[model samples]
Target: MSLSHEIMKNICGYSRAKYSTWFYYRPDHILFDAGEGVSLALRNMIYGIDHIFISHNHGDHIGGLPGLIKSRASSMGDITKPLSIYYPEKDSQILQFKEYLDVSIPKLPFVLTWKGLRPGDQISLNANRFVEAFASDHMGTLSLGYKIIEKRKRLKSEYKGLPQQELIACIKDLGREAIHEEYHKNLLVYSGDTMPLDVSIVQNAEVLLHDATFVLGSDREENTHATVEEACELAIKAQVACLALFHFSSRYSHQQVKDKIYEIITANNVEIPIHYIYPHFYPSDFKQIQIEN
Candidate 1:
């Protein structure tokens, strides 16, 4: 299978604009925005999560924390595993959620840590991969987006086109770093509850999960969330290999949502694969439709 397809199979989540929004990226054991029903949806898989990244403090985005934490403590999973949570710096709403967890689960068995982060802050997932935060334009809150970046080494510009034997000799003489340059590849990007993001933030990502809360631009009474077309446009401009739109408003029917996305894809001649979570689908039945490229 293609790398993008393999990555898609590992991700599962549910999103409804005003109700809930969350994503569980299995490969990294990272949960983005623990929304309502997260614990129930994830069930035993809750034990696999090593980190939770909160975009903002909206209740819909953080309501699942208490359940998730409590379940990990009381459920059949390993109770001593450490769990870390990262969120936008000084978000009062998230602080309130933490306080609630403290009161609700005072005697937790695990070592839970919460750290505040800024837009440029980065948390290492491993030696070569890390999660980086970036600002997002979600009104009424200090929202942020996240990028999963992988650090890779490549031959320096001057060393390109050299014969294989010559390259080996050069590598031995100059050492690896001297002949190589490091570049960051964006594996995935999640724009949590935001309007259309700046292209630069999600450029060239293998996958982009963006907010698409409105089927039509005219349906938006407020500019808090992006419309489906806007999200697709941004994905195209950013050159993302795959786009998975979530956080759709519950007002639209499944057919309406699918039709609108199809219209956008056809009208723009979008070549990259597009996927979306139908808001009406139950969490247990949650499966994104991968629109043909």
Candidate 2:
């Protein structure tokens, strides 16, 4: 609900669906898909970022590359930290796209580190959170989804003044000697834009972000994408703690999609805590959402 922990600005949504962009900050500040002027928004707001992950090589996804490169060139001179980029590569599409950007923006002034995006790759940020990349289905281009895993550190507040090295040695010598014990860490999985697939990938996650582009009875295919009903089915199958639907089609209104999804799930007699990412909504318009730790 806060701006930093989980702020999803709908830079592009349910409007022409051409520029489908979103800046989601959960495990880290991630620029989902760079649409028109998205780089300008990031340059103005987001900070502490030296990496960029692209879901696909679509124009909407990589459109802002030139602008961002130019901006970086204009700002810092010869920055030590290179711009890290991750994108799926079935061929040399990612490389060619990057080369196009580089040649287009010759004055990039800084180093650019580009890497191939592979599925089942565990991505960790600092020591607090880790992100796992998975394959996603997008038209003719390669796409990927991300799962954010927040590792928990169990701190025993009662054993504050106790010895440090001795405690660890004692635990090694004596089993369960220490009072600290870490349990299952929290996880959040996001399916950028995909069709039906294995749900086991998100079994360890507490929250799931599903792509509910279309509704039921709409034209859906394995090669195409999922609808609202399809996303609900996947969420129900995964049985995750919570599910948030995103990436709706531009044809349907927000209210229409909301009502249709509710009706279909209810008709099927399945229930779960479902949330819609309504970026246009705020505390003044919609009631304050319950904050969870």
Candidate 3:
């Protein structure tokens, strides 16, 4: 299987525009959003999440916080584990929701933290992995996109093409750091709910889960969401290894959604495998619909 396929196997999610959207990246124990039915969909797996990154304060994006928190506290799992939630700084709606949760669930068993983040802020996952926040255009309120980055080491340009023995000797004599340079690779980029992102933001990412709220360009009357064509174009321009479109509007049928995406991929000759989450009932299996061109 391709690396993208392997990565997708570990992720489970559900998205329906103006309704709900959530993704559980099992590898990192992170949830992107806590839309309605998230707790029910994940069931016992909800306790596995250690962190949640909220993109915006939209109801569809954050309606499940109460259930998720209560489930972690009272469900059939470890209730003492702490969970951290990160959101765009100064989001009033989210702050209000947090207050409500505090008032409603005063005696929580587990530690729950809510931290606001600005663009360029990062939360360390490990010594070499982190989640960084970036500004995104969605609503009047500040919204954010997230990128999961991993630090990797590569041989210095000057050491490239050197014989294996020579490289080994250089590493031995000058130390590994001296012979290599550190680079950041984007493991995943989540464009929560917004227009087509700038190519630079998602450049070379292994997987990009972008907003595809409209299948027909003419149907989009506002600039808040992206069309199917725009998402595909962004993926190609960014050279992302994999594209997974989500948050589709319910107006389009499953076949309509697939046809539009296929049209775009074929027109552009997009080589990366494209996947989509249709806007229907929130699926329990959460398998992404894959499209190849």
Candidate 4:
């Protein structure tokens, strides 16, 4: 199924313990990373992407930039759409890659812009939605995580006790500003290749796509990727609506990964729905593979 039609569906291009990792949030036209084979896997759907956010300069995270750029320029899709790429500030590898693409594809059919992002940087998607970057623990490689926030207005606590007629009269006489408060809601959080960190960063999120590169804690490396158990704990602690785990280690079979996740959820009594992307497989629909709570 095409992910573009579903507002909550996500597209993933990842092969754990391999050379590629990426997630495409179709509703926002935002791509979390540009890992290898991303352009090929997405095909024409790539034309819809207007913003590409790179978590870090790791080869597995950014190896597909050149191909994606070239395809957008030369393919049968619209060539006039502007593409903006955001990466960590002062990332040597990304800087080098930018220079390389400049020299290799000197003349492109569309405009390509690059921005350096720092921790806590926010990029506005529209008037109501925006994306914020946060520092992630990934072997000290200057990695970052992203959160999608939406601005919303809610009725003030005092207004909740008022009758409907009173509320309508208040709105008519005092205006909405007097009875409502604007707040930001966390829609989705993507933990790009990071070890488990504070759960508060992703509290109350609608969905969380986290790194689960290892199934066993014994297999986890110091300050690197998170294991399945860690991802589950964070999701449960944060009370997220759903957790989608990706970046599984290639050493484990699909059955092994599923078994471990079930074991963890059962042991901890986690109530949130948990989903996983099988290693080496490209899932067309994200919701189909969710494991029962």
Q: Residues 1-293, candidate 1, lDDT per residue (tens digit)? A: 86766777788899888788899999999999999999999999999999999999888999899899999999998999999999999988788878988997998889999999999899999999999999999886899999999999999999999999999999899888899999999999999999999999999999998998999899888879999999999999999998888888888888888898888877878888888888777763334544564
Q: How high is the CA lDDT of each candidate model?
A: 0.89, 0.61, 0.89, 0.84
lDDT of 2 by residue, 95-136 (tens): 888778877777645677777768978666767776668888
- Which tens-of-lDDT digit does each residue in 1-293 have in candidate 3? 87777777887889988889999999899999889999998999988899999999989989999999988989899999999999999888899999999999889998899999999999999899999999888965699999999999998899999999998899899988898899999999999999999998999999999998999999988889988889999989889999988988898998898788777777777778888877674563433445542
Q: Which of 3 and 4 is the better model by TM-score?
A: 3
Stretches of candidate 3 off by over 4 Å are 281-293
Q: Let me know the TM-score candidate 1 reaches against the reference structure.
A: 0.96
Worst 10 residues of 4 by lDDT: 1-10
**Highest-lDDT candidate:** 1
Predicted structure 1: lDDT: 0.89
- Model 2 stretches astray by more than 4 angstroms: 1-16, 75-81, 152-186, 268-272, 277-293
Clashes, model 1: 0
